[model samples]
Target: MTTKKPVVVELYDEIVFPDPSEAFLSRVQGHPAVNLPRLPAGVTLPPPIPVEDASKRRKGDTKDHSLTQWFTNFSEADELLQLAAARQRVQAHIAKLRRQISLIDGQQQQFKSTPEQ
Candidate 1:
């Protein structure tokens, strides 16, 4: 008797994925609002002014740079320091107010308990 060998079959040989670039292009092309510039009505853009002098231009380094970069380099330690300082000040104020209220309540109770002189 002759031994028979079974043939192996491959599946998904014809399966192909679509190109990402082509898919993106197709999506943008299909969308109607992809290329339109969105702006409110009655807002006319001013004409471009040529900057002829660099010497006369006001520098924003001292003002804008400080504001924009104020917290850029901040660390958790710095935040905790500020938070602790604020908490201490607030807690002190609250303690003072509470003491004042307690004194007022004590005075009121004393006035009520004292007989008319």
Candidate 2:
């Protein structure tokens, strides 16, 4: 029988809002003085710039081989790199511990086999 790996799925939505200044203008320019409805709790408003415009601006401003830009702009990449390094370190430590445990077990077996002098 073959075991199948589980598939993981993630969903994300991107929202873009005009800058605060623009929102402010919209609020102030409203001809009616009716009280505006409140937004849902924990719901955040997006910035004024459109998502496409923001992406274009980021691409234009960043250059290849820029460490700060890479670190700041690509958190998923940075996190993966960090996780890889951590896994390597953990594996190394586990191997060392295994060797130490084996050595201790061998010593214990040897001492047990030797008759009390």
Candidate 3:
């Protein structure tokens, strides 16, 4: 005896694939799939700024004008200046060492000319 099993079927909404000619026609007709939101008149985001203004707020009457209200504490600047000075000193020391090496090389050359008995 042969038994027949019923076929299971799944149905879905009809999806139309766009024709190449239709796509070109829609593109030529100025149909955009996604549109950008428009901002209201006279509204804008604030301008960018640097890190030095961390402790202050924007000031002055002009639209983009700004100022630093508080003077930076001297200790921080002094420390930075000291660091720069130390770097300069180290560079000078390296230059002096190079000069000393050149002098030693010259002296060795001079001693090389003297004959040993």
Candidate 4:
């Protein structure tokens, strides 16, 4: 009797991986407010801007570069956003304090203008 050979069968041959060249690149996620400008290959990064000492700055003073245009990740963006919000809150609180002082000054002037018995 002749020995019979079993035929090998292949399943899911239609499944194929996408070509690397044709593949879509995922966008780098960052802060919503930040603009992510792509730099060309071999391009050198710009020099870092010098930051001033915090102790010398006046209270509630804001710096232009406090919120940077570029960020690496979500956490960095969140941190910068929090800093901005805190700065705004400080400014608002200062304004409120100034308004209170003005009101107190006005009341003092009213007392001064009144004739004493």
lDDT of each: 0.65, 0.68, 0.64, 0.63
Please provide, for model 4 over 31-102, each residue's C-alpha lDDT reduced to its tens digit, 9 standing for 90 to 100: 466576788899666553444554555554343334434543335456678999999999999999999999
Q: Which stretches of candidate 4 lie over 4 Å from their true place?
A: 1-74
The number of clashing residue pairs in each candidate reads 0, 4, 0, 0
The root-mean-square deviation over C-alpha atoms between each candidate and the true structure, in angstroms, is 23.1, 10.0, 25.3, 25.2
TM-score of each: 0.39, 0.45, 0.35, 0.36
Which residue ranges in model 3 land beyond 4 Å of their true spot?
1-54, 57-74
Candidate 1 Cα misplacement greater than 4 A, ranges: 1-71
Judging by TM-score, tell me the better candidate of 3 and 4: 4
Candidate ranking (TM-score, best to worst): 2, 1, 4, 3
lDDT tens digits, residues 1-117, model 2? 446876779998855344558767677658497466676899655534555655665343433323443245545556678999999999999999999999999999999999997
lDDT of 3 by residue, 1-117 (tens): 446877779998854333458777667556666365566799664544554663364332233233222233334456768999999999999999999999999999989998987
Error of model 3, residue 114, in angstroms: 3.2
Model 3, residue 72: displacement in angstroms?
15
Worst 10 residues of 3 by lDDT: 60-69
Off by over 4 Å in 2: 1-24, 28-74
lDDT against true structure, model 2: 0.68
Best by TM-score: 2
Q: Write the per-residue lDDT of candidate 1 for residues 33-99, one digit (tens) a residue.
A: 7685655798555532344543354553233222333335544556778999999999999999999
